[model samples]
Target chain A: MTCKEVTRLISESLDRELPFYQRLSLHAHFHLCIFCKRYARQLLFIRETLRSLSQRIEDPVFSLPPLSEEARESMKRRIREQVLPPDQGNLEQ
Target chain B: MNRKQPIDQHQTSHPEVWVDQHGDYLFRYALLRLQNAELAQDLVQDTFLAALRARHSFTGQSSERTWLVGILKHKIIDYLRRSWRECPVDEIDSSLNSIEEFFDKTGHLRDISHGWTADPGTILEQREFQGILERCLAELPFRTATAFSLREMDGLPAEEICKILGISSGNLHVLLYRARTHLRHCLEIHWFVKIRKD
Candidate 1:
């Protein structure tokens, strides 16, 4: 495959696994082609950053503002009712 | 004393414990995607209620946090999916312009010769780095950001994201590609490049 084809495949590979021979050729191309190597590294950088950021963002105590005291009480009350809350409140754009 | 309950009777503990133990985490998780305090809190409420209803399915295979996060993820997706359908599909974002510029007439990268002086991906672990990442994510177009979050952060299947975003498989690929490339450029310029230069 040409460099252009391999680069596009790199994005597709993120969604699903690449084909076996295609994976082999892409890996082979990485060694022989500087642009493909750089392209692959950039994608990896994005994935790694996202994964780590996702992990930290979800930490039980990662330091984003906690739910307010009143919000907590309101939440507990709603949960205790054991019914889905009304959809009066919509997500802000 | 771990007594296994039937799937229908899978009650583990009172629901209030969930508020104390998980309310904050779930709120932040939702806020990261929704970026709205009210919606985030509301989604956490919905997740807790849903957990109560499906308590029987709490098989104890995962940590409570993990279980709660799973429920929260679904609530966010369902919420976003509904909202996405209500709103018109956004105009194509300018974020793709730089990506187009990266390639030449033929699809080869215009200039991809150099690599990072060091792999800056690890810097994302820092709290400040995470803040920067969130800002970058917030800058993306609504559907672009949602498509990215559903796929990358929530780890939803591409097919699932396609359904939620009301996009085709081909469109989903391009959307995800646009999101990642845009974010990469953002983080590169805002954090990586700034830090490396300094």
Candidate 2:
């Protein structure tokens, strides 16, 4: 297979599960082609970086700047108004 | 007053009371994923309303936070569906795009730099680099960004992302490949390139 083809298989390889083959041919190629090997490593690095970045987004901490208190109160107000009947919500207010 | 809630995803009927408990967390989650403050806030608001409307179906098997997140995921999916653009994602013939851009026609490394050789750990630790990365991600097309984030960042499987983003597994892989390629290039230009010049 071409080096370009090997690079695509390299990406497919990183998923680490659901076993996509062509791994043999892909590896055979990188043995001969240092450039494509480096490219494969770089692809893995980028995938690692993106995964690391997502850790923050996935379990996002509350410390990140939030809506202002006024906005929060306003949103609560809007939600309350939507979920509750006007008279009942107003009476509680 | 800010005691951490235990990690039980059991459902609760008091989603109305959840604003004080989960609002900011939800907003932060959406903000990190979507990168739009107003949209995130709106999503938090909308998610609450949706839970209230659908409270009947929420079996209390999961924790309140888990249940709310379930609703929130639906909102995110709906947003992705509504916002996805057509062919710029799929129809551009990216088959040759990577080969031409990164590798020479003879498949040798050309002018393109696999040159971002900085420590990935150190680079991730840099807050400014992270900010730059987020901005670069925001620059990606809507569906491309969503598919990439859901898979790489959020640690989702390809099949699930395909279902959520409404695309085939093949399309999902293509988008992910392109997203990684674009992000690597963008990070190099913004982060490594700047570091090298400095």
Using Cα atoms, each model's DockQ against the true complex is 0.32, 0.35
lDDT string, candidate 1, A1-93, tens digits: 776678777878889887899899899988888878777788777776666656776554355778999989987887766532321122211
TM-score of chain A of 2: 0.59
Q: What tens-digit string does per-residue lDDT give for candidate 2 at B119-174?
A: 76557777787788777887776666777778776778777877776778777776
Return model 1's CA RMSD, one decimal. Answer: 7.3
Candidate 2 positional error at B42, Å: 1.9
**Candidate that would win on lDDT:** 1
* Top TM-score hit: 1
Clashing pairs for predicted structure model 2, backbone only? B9-B62, B9-B63, B10-B62, B10-B63, B11-B62
Task: Please give, for residues B1-198, the per-residue lDDT of candidate 1 as tens digits.
Answer: 124323333446667788998888888888877878998988888888888777767888897789999889878878888887876655456434546766687777665445655444456446677688778887787777788888777778898778767789888887777777677666667776667667
Superposition error at B174 for model 2 (Å)? 2.0
List lDDT for all candidates, in order.
Answer: 0.74, 0.68
Which residue ranges in model 2 land beyond 4 Å of their true spot? A15-21, A58-64, A86-93, B1-17, B55-61, B85-99, B111-122, B193-198
What does the interface RMSD come to for each candidate? 7.8, 6.7
Question: Where is the poorest 10-residue window by lDDT in model 1 chain B?
Answer: B1-10
